[model samples]
Target: MSKTTIIDKEAARQIREGMKADCTKCFSLCCTALNIVASSDFSINKPAGTPCLNLQPNYSCQIHSQLRDKGFKGCTVFDCLGAGQVVSQVTFKGQSWRGNPEIGKKMFQVFPIMEQLHEMIAYVSEALSYEIPEDIADKLSIQLKKLQYLTELDADDLLALDLIMYRFSLNELLTIASNFVREKAISKLPGNRNIKDFDHARVDWIGKKLEGKDLRASDFRGAYLIASDMRNSDLREVNFIGADLRDVNLGGADLSTSMFLTQMQINSAKGNEMTRLPIYIQKPSHW
Candidate 1:
């Protein structure tokens, strides 16, 4: 447990804003650190720690505008949640791996760790935005402080962290907060006394046709929703933490109040202009 800092709504908003990726401040760490398998998503198979073929000397993607058209759809969906800039500027002190080849390996390793930490911070910050019980809010605040502190640590310390354990602990609080919010939403639904029916956490719905369904306040945590057709569905207040939304059709769906739905998830899915999204998430240009 870390020293708890009281995070008001405004502070939570600021924390989330700081977690957005700014490529100009980054050194194209994702292009080098992550492995790309040759699937429909990627044009080529690239090993970890190796730079992508499209990476330029200035760390900009050569095929940036044509990534999807150039058979590199995977690159389009990946979002580091501002971890690249934090690693490049703060962790490595504004050093580029290209300039200092010796730091490349370690910097690559640290990037993923920082990405996960930032994601956890984003989720906690989102939880704090809701009207949860004070006890849960206090615990979430402590966890947020701990995660923020971890991000500022040296590379070795970050590599030594047990992220699985941390994720498990943080997920407990997130689950509670999600349940609190969903329950309130469910209570307002017409004839919505069957609470157990909405507990669809971790269900396998891959490629299922769920068009125009009333799935409001449902818990889809860790669910595999790949290629599922959820067009025009009522997904308001649904908990989507860790749900695989790849290629899911959300055309005309209303997710304006969805919980824990990250930008990465939304980017991977197919949405139309009519699809209502949460205020924090931006609609993908491809949609």
Candidate 2:
């Protein structure tokens, strides 16, 4: 992978001080290269590799205020560990993906790798903040140095990098993520009749532990599913527009072919490979 020089002190301070990190330095690659689909959390549908219509010329989300109402719940869930601002300012020196459309895609492709590195930084920093692990200090130093290098590389070098190097550190951090922050908490809220594309007369959610539930083609318009556990529910062809699904555990829910649902909403919900979403609702390239 290409070496990166994006770990400047200003960027580092954001991670250290903001709890929330901005990767604006790398030219807002996430906003430009990524598509945000519509779902219960976000109301609009976005296509892959296409700049979101909701994204402003400044590369900020135009609907940041009403993200939840518009079906952008996923955006709310993501924490970049200060990657955006750093990538914008430190690595690429504030150049935006918009300036060079062809190179833009390449920059976008490099983003996930950098994001992974930063996530580790956040995880490690969190650990050090709680209590220093004296034995892990040496290991942590090595990773920090690697993290700094990973941010400065051009797209070509990043693509060429041997993932095994980053994987070594990542494997160690994954354990920490699992031990300290595995699904800290989740809640499932009820959807209102805000969006109705299915018949409410022929469905049932009462007492249904939806985790892994299979409801493909079932009508679920205006259902009161508050606190319902639908984590891995199979909801192909079911209607969920206007559904209130806050705090729902949908880690592995399958809503492939779900009716009247937008990509943004699907992206908003919590999911994984097990979480079946519409074909349009692309799964995260990362695990």
lDDT tens per residue, model 2, 119-164: 6565443333322234444454456666667777766777777766
TM-score per prediction, in order, is: 0.96, 0.52
- Cα lDDT tens digits for candidate 1, 1-287: 32345687788877776678999999899999998899999989999999999999989999999999999998889998999999999999988899677799899999999999999999999999889988888899989989999999998998899999999999889999999998898889998376677988889999999999999999999999999999999999899999999999999999999989888999999999999998788899889
lDDT of 2: 0.54
- Residue 59 miss distance in model 1 (angstroms): 0.7
Error of 1 at 130 (Å): 0.2
Leading candidate by TM-score: 1
Model 1, runs deviating above 4 Å: 1-5
Candidate 2 Cα RMSD after full superposition onto the native fold (Å): 14.6
